[model samples]
Target chain A: MTPILIALTIGIPWLGAIIVWLMGDRREDLTHWVSILFSIGAAITSVLLLPNASQETALTIPIGGDFGDFTFVADGLGIFLSVIAAVIGSLAVIFSKSYMKGEGSLGRYYAFVLFFIGAMVGLVLSSNLLLIFLFWEITALCSYALISFHNDDPKAVKGGIKALIITSIGGVGLMVGALIVYAYTGSYDINNFLANYSTIPGNILALLAFGFLIAAAAKSAQFPFQTWLPDAMEAPSPISALIHAATMVNAGVYLLARFYPAFKDVPYWSEAVMIVGALSALLAAVMALVSNDLKRVLAYSTVSQLGYMVYAIGTGSVYASQFHLFSHSIFKALLFLSAGAVIHSIGTRNMLEMGGVGKKHPLVKWVFIIGALALAGLPILNGFWSKELILESGLKNGPLWLYIVMVFVAGLTALYTIRCVWLVFFGEPRSDYHAHAIGWEMIAALLPLAGAALVSWLAAGRFSVLLGEKSLPFHAIEPLPYKEMMHEILSLPTLVVMAVITAAILLWVFRKKLEGLINGLKSIRWAAENSFGFEAINNAIVKVTQSTAEALRVTQTGILNWNVFGILASVILLLAILVLGA
Target chain B: MNLPIPLVVLITILCLAGIGLYCLLITRNLIKVVIALQLIVKGAVLAFILAGNMTGQLNLAQSMALTVIVADTIVAVVGLALAVQIRLKTGSLDIKSLSSLKR
Candidate 1:
């Protein structure tokens, strides 16, 4: 039963991708419905596997080589992420049906989206590093294709290429780490590595530990690699909701938590992770505060939220990290989909052009508010409970200074969230832009996520049990019940919440004064707007690669004889070197 | 049977490969380039046959040589066709003029 469930979770979306691709854009309606059905099927299978989350290696195929066994574990961590991928993926597909209505190349859009779902599920479930890397690359390819789904737009195409190149660099990190492990253990099985990682020499183990950290940071858009994700907003909003917000970005923190036991002892490793997370959270929050583009703001917030999870892992709180990941996946998806509805209606992503939109589209307005409240960590929402847990764990187990910085970041999160809500939904009409009526399909897609954001923290007790009792190296004490969790969160002097509220109210009341202050800090705003010169650095790297390729093009010659001469000379040189070595 | 056949074959293979590569690098005419390419293929075939003979796999070497000949013939035919097309289009077979195909 478990094997079949795992197969269905992965295989359904894959099969759906092919079927939807064949259906083509001529029957866009059919293609959309097929994608939704397949995504839901995958989601259902993942839910079915939840009860069996205690089972390790629920299914295995003996591939019989250095590749090791192809295995899937229905463990708590894997199953939890799989469910998020599939369920949120289904909602995104449903939302896309409306958001992408009458769009060209519907077949291609749905195909890549469904394929990404399967790849993400496979990525989380696989217990073999080789298979994980394969699935990882597949997700990257899917993201590239989907981000450039608007292929006619030059910006979209450039964004897609940048995403592919940067993520592939990270993929190389993961591949190198996997190969190093295989070199030492002669197996690619993750279970094998996890069980006896310390038996490997300390220096080599440290190298592997940092290599995996690089991979996670790159994948999750932590720090220096984060500029790619905000640019990835060029993708359709539904794709943003599904891949960037809910599933794919979480893979980085998931990687850290999944391998925490092996890497926890590596000197300065946890500190490095904490620093990466803290910097990303703070920087992305400031970027979010300054950005006028709605989706870009949300994209930056997603990075900030992911940083908290990474910070949780760094603080030796895998359960806190995973729990926050759950809450974030729910609310962020809701926010993105609601933002999608708004963008689809107004046909622009700029928040300055979007005032009084809530008056026109009340349903979207309310749902967006719900998402914002959850994101800002207001009490009684899932984000509040999970975020408090992360901060609590950080304070208790990690550095006090880092914990203090994260709390300040929480205030920044609230300031940006409310600012986003006000500029888009509440302010005086800043422009004459008209909004389309909120569609039922978009509202339907948002409803479940909103409910989850409101009530999902009730599952904290069960989740704690699953993490503590079943998964090794993740022995979180059983979490407090919902009532006690709320009391605990409310009883922490409420300093962060108070700061957030005060900052939000002051920003709202003194808009003119703050505008002057914001203008006074022109240099800081300029730096934030340009992602603090990281974009320039990345662009220089790209330019160098292009120029190097141009230099190499001198050898192409277009003359057949010269080309053959080049190949023959290289072959002869290699042979000579081999002979000399022998 | 006791002659230095292996050494003689090795020297011949080296000379053929060197000559082939020199022609390829120095040739101006597309047809001469094609001939040079074939000469390199012939050297490779000779080396394969010599190695197989030394290992007592004469039959296998002969069969491989035959396969190489067939493949080379097909390649030569296609190359000449492409050369013809290039000549007809450009009114010259000078390899330098063919550089127009470069992006």
Candidate 2:
């Protein structure tokens, strides 16, 4: 039954692709309904399985006979993420109807989207390293296809290729780690590795830990490999909400959480993970602050948020990481889908062209405001509780200095969240360019996400238990009347920090009057815009690889008879050796 | 006891494999690559037959070899078709000219 269900997780979406293809491009109404039903069905299955998944029962299937088996434990970690993926994926599909209308190749688009949803489910559920890698690559494939869905545009094509190349590098790291584990343990099962990791040599285990680190960093868009994700904004908005913001990027954090038990003992691994997470969060926050493109800003914000999750895992707060993963998924999805609604109506992703949009699209305004408040970790929102939990975990479990850095990041997160909202919704109206009208599909998608963004934190206890047996130790601030639930988010220090940061950003946003006294860091701005010149470095590497391949191809003479003779000689030598041995 | 004809055929097969690898390394022409692949397949078939003779495994080696031959034929057929298409598109079979997939 477990094997059948596991197979269904991956197989169902791919099968849906077939049904979608059969429906044809002429019938989009049929296509949208099919996609909605398929994804919702997948989400329900994932939810039903969550309660059964806890610490006790894990599902397993032996694949490829004697090689290894695919194992999935519905443990705290996997089910939490599976729920996020399925739920967000269904919402994003529902949202796409208005966003995708009048767009070409609707059939192909939905097929790939549904296919990616299934792949993400498979990726999180797989406890076999090899199977995880397979699903990982498949998601990369889907991402590439979706990002480049508008094949006629060169920029979209370029974005897709860049995403493919960068993520494939992560795939290599994951494969290498898997092979290292297999070399030591004689099996590809993750549970077996986790169970017996202590028996492996320390140096070998450390290498495996570092290998997985590189894999996680690349997939989650930590520091160096993060440039690809912002560029991936060329994908349609619904795809961005589903793939980039909510689901696919979390694969790296999931991996780190999964292996933390084994790697926590290795020297410098957790430290390295924390440092990477901190730097990425801080750097991406700065990037988001400077970005004028609406989608690109959100893209950078996703990277920054992922950095916090990575840092939480590094700090040994597995619950903090998973909880943030849960909250980030809903709020970020809400934000992206709301942004999608705005972009769909305005037909522009540039914030420079958008202002006073909220007055006209009042529903969109309220929905987006809810998403933005949650993103800023404002009081009474789901993000406030989760981000506070993470920050508290960093203080208690992580180094003091690291907690300081995270607190600073929280302030920055608030500043930018306000900056984005103020610019898009509250500022003077920009020129009203041609735009698509908001539709029922858009409203249907955005409203529920906003609600989730508000209420999802109620599952905090359930999430903490799922992460491990240890109940989370959280400090509640008093004197607000409804102290246990609502007022717990606000206190003297939290309120002071929020008010101070919000004021600072307002000053910064309106700082033209104080421009003469402002810091003139032109070099920093230049560096951030150019991705710290990593583009040039990556291009150089691509050049060297291409040149090396060209140099090697000179040997392929392409002659028919000469090649025939070469093969003949090698076979004769091999046969002679075999016959002599016999 | 004398070795059978099959043993001699297998030895010849190894000689062909050696030649094929050499050609694959040394040749520059596109058509040569295709022919070398065929030689490798043929050598593989000959080795299988020889193994059958030693183990008294009747028809197993022959059928497996036949399968390789079939695969080789299919590959060759595809190669030839691609070559024809390339010649029409580029007016030459030179791989250097046809390396459009390069960055």
Give the top-scoring candidate (lDDT).
1
The DockQ figures for the candidates are 0.60, 0.18
Model 1, span A109-143: residue lDDT tens: 99899899999999999989999999999999999
Q: What is the i-RMS of every prediction?
A: 1.7, 6.7
Q: Against the native chain B, what TM-score does each candidate's chain B reach?
A: 0.90, 0.82
Query: Candidates' lDDT values, in order?
Result: 0.89, 0.81
- Number of the top candidate by TM-score? 1
TM-score of each: 0.94, 0.86
Worst 10 residues of 1 chain A by lDDT: A471-480
Tens digit per residue, CA lDDT, model 2, A1-582: 544555665677778888887786888788888988888888777777666654433566655765686776555566667778887888888888778877778889989988898889888877778989999999999999999999999999989999998898889999999998998998987777877888999998999999889988888889888889998999998899989989999999988988888999899998999999998998888788778889999999999999999998888877667778888889898898889888888888889889988877888889888988888778668888878767766776788888778778777787777878888887777886655579898888888888888888877765555555421112111211233434444555466557756775677578778765445766677777777777789889889999998899866654544455566678789999999999
In order, what fnat does every candidate score?
0.74, 0.04
Kindly give the stretch of ten consecutive residues in candidate 2 chain A with the minimal lDDT sum: A471-480
